[model samples]
Target: MLPFTYALRNLFRDPARLLQTVGGAALVVLLLIAAVALNEGMNSVLENSGSTKNVILMGKGSEESIERSEVPLSAESAVATSVRGLQEVLGVSAVSGEIFYQAPLHIAQGKESQALLRGVLENALLVHRSVQLIDGRFPQSGEVMVGHLAHRKLGVAEEDLAVGESLYFGDTELKIAGRFIAPGTVLESEVWFDRNDLAVLTQRDSLSSVTVRMDAAEFEDVEVFTLQRNDLELAAISEQGYYDKLSTFYEPIKVMTWVTAALVAAGALFGGLNTLYAAFAARIREMATLQSIGFTRKALFVSLIQESLLATLTGTLVAFILGYFILDGLAVPFSIGTFTLTLTPSVIGVGLITGVLLGTIGTLPPAIRCLAPSLPSALRSS
Candidate 1:
C-alpha cells in the first residue's frame, strides 16, 4: 500500500492545475450548498411563523395569505361561540379577528414604497409570540409599529420613530409608536396597527382572516365546523400548513436554483475529470515502474483516488467556511421580497457529501484507464 503522503504530494506537484481543479469543484459545491440553504431558510421562515396550537380561519378558498381573502368581522363572534374546546382568557375565547392589507408607505421624504399592513388586537400578540418588540412601545390606535427590516428600509432609527412622528399612508397620518421584529419571517416587511384603526383607515370594517388558539383536541372540531358552516364561507387550517403554501411563491427561485446547480456540477465534474485524466496519463511510466517493482493495479487506483478525495475535501472545507461566514448571512435584495441567506446544519452536510462524491466519481474512470497498461510496456516507455 502507498503512503497517503505520496498521493497528496502528487496532487500538489502542479500548483496551477491543483488550484483550477479544486476551485471548480469548490464552486460547484458552494452553489449546491447555497441553493439548499436558500430553500431551507425560506422554509424555516414560513414554518417558524406559527405555533402548533394555533389555527388560521380564512375565507373558504383562501390559503395562507390573508391579503387575498376577505372575511366579515362578525365571523369572529360566530367562531368563538360555535367552536367547542375553544379556551378563553379574560372572558374572550382563544380567537382573534385580524386584517391584512398592502399599503403604500412613504418612508423617504419625497418617495413612496409599498409595505404590508397587519392589524391585530393586543390579545393577538399574546397568541403569536413571534411578534417581539425590540424597541419603544406597542402602537396604539392611530399609531403604527414598523418591523426591523421596514425600519432599515425606511432608514428610520429608534429615536426617529417617536410616538408622535407622522407616517403618511394614503389619506391617514399614522403615528410611529414602536419597532417590532419577527426575524426571518415575512412579518419583517410589514407595519402593524390596531385592528379598529386599520378598519377605519382602509374603509373595510370586515377582516381579512381570523386566528384561533385551540388545544390539540379542538383542531378537528374547528376545522370541520368552519368548513361545514352554511352561514359563513370559511375554512380553518394549521398556521404551518398555511405558510408551506407560500413555497409556491418561491417556485421560480427554487427552479432557478436546481437548474444552476445542475449546470455547475456538470461543468465542474468534467473539468475535474479532464484534470485527473491528464495528471494520471503523465504518470503512466511512473505507475508502470511502481507496478514492475511490485505495486498492484488496485493499489495504484486507491492511491489516485485518495489524491482526488484529498483535494476535494480541502475545497469543501474552505467553501463551507466561506459560505457560512460571508455568503449565508448576507441580505439578498429583490424587488418582490428580500431575505438573508442562511446556512444550517443540513446544508453543511449536503455540501460535504457532494464534494466527496464528486471526487470519487470524477477520478475513477481516468485512474483505471491509465492503469490498464502492462508493467513491461510502462517500464519500456519510462
Candidate 2:
C-alpha cells in the first residue's frame, strides 16, 4: 500500500494537469449548485406568493393569467358580503380587488422596462398579510408604492424608485409614495397603485381579479359562490392552486435550464477524464515498478482515487466560496417577478455530492486503462 503522502506529493508533479482537474470539477459543481438553486428559488418564490387561506376570483377561462381576467367592480363588494367566514380585520372584510397589468414604466433617469403592476385598495394589505410597509405609507390617489425588489424588475437603480421619486406610466406621472416588502413572494417585484388611479391610467373599469382571505370557510365554499353566481361570470381558484399552476406553466423553461446544465457538465466530465487519463498514463511505469515491489493494483487504484478526490474537493470548496459571494441573495428577474437565489443547505448538499461523484466516477475509466497492462510488458519498455 502506498503512503497517503505519496499520493499527495505526486499531485504537484504536473501543475497543469492538477489545475485542469480542479478547474473542471469546480465548473461542474458550480453549475450543479447554480441550476438547483435557480429552480429552487423560482419554485420557492412562486409557492410563497400564494397562501392557503386565500382564493382568487377571476373571470372564467382566464385562470392562466390574472392580467387577462376581469371581474365586475361590483364583485368585490358582493364577495365580501356573500362569502361568510372570510377573514375580518378591524371589522373590514379581507378582500382586495386588484388590477394586474404589465407595461413599460419609465423612470426619470433610467431606461424603460416592463414591470408588473398591481392596483389595489388599502384593504389589499389585509388580504396579503405578508406585505409590510418598510418605508413611507400606502399609496394614495395619483401616487404609487414600489416593492423592495421592484427596481430589479424595472431595470433601474434602486434610488430611481425610492420614496419621493416619480415614475411615468404612459403619459401620467405617478409619485413613489412608499416601499413595501413581501418576503420570499413575487409580490416584492411589483409596483402597487391606487385601484382607481390604475383603472384611469389603463382606461378600464373592471378589476383584474378579486382576492379574499378565508377564516372558517374553505376553498369549496368559494368555488360554490362562483358557481352559484352565474351572473358574475367568475371562476374560483385557491391562491396556492393558482401559483402551482403557474409553476407548471414555466416547467419548460426549467427543463431547458436542466438540459443546458447537463450538457455543460458532460463536457466538464469528459475534459476532467481526459486530464486524468494523461496524468495517469505517464505514471504507468511507476505503477508497474511499485507492483513489482509488492504494491497491489488495488492499493494503487485507491491512491489514485485519493489524489483525484483531493483535487475535486479543493475545487468544490472554491465553488462554494464563489457561489456564496455571487449567487447568494442575488435577485433574478423573470416574467412574473424577481426571485432571490440563495445557498440553502440543500444546495450545498447537492454541490458536495456532485464533487464526490466527479472525483470517483470520472476517475474510473482513466485509472483502469492506466493499470490494465501486463506486468512484464509494462516493466520492459518505458
Q: Pick the candidate with the highest lDDT.
A: 2
Model 2 lDDT tens row, 1-382: 7999998998899898889888888999999999999999999999999999999999999999999998999999999999899999889999999999999998988579999999999999999999999999999998999999999998888988889999999878999999999999999999999999999989999999999999999989889999889999999999999999999999999999889999999999998887888888888898899999999999999999999999999999999999999999999999999999999999999999999988898889999988999998778757
In order of appearance, the predictions have TM-scores of: 0.87, 0.99
Q: Which ten residues in a row have the lowest lDDT in candidate 1?
A: 330-339
Q: Against the hidden true structure, what lDDT does model 2 obtain?
A: 0.93
Which numbered prediction scores highest in TM-score against the true structure? Answer: 2
Find the 10 residues in a row with the least total lDDT in model 2: 373-382
The residue-by-residue lDDT of candidate 1 on 190-296, one tens digit each, is 77888889888888868898888885456788888776785778888887777667766777888898898889788888887888888888899999988878888
How many residue pairs clash in all the candidates, one count each?
Answer: 0, 0
TM-score of 2: 0.99
In model 1, the Cα lDDT at residue 159 comes to 49
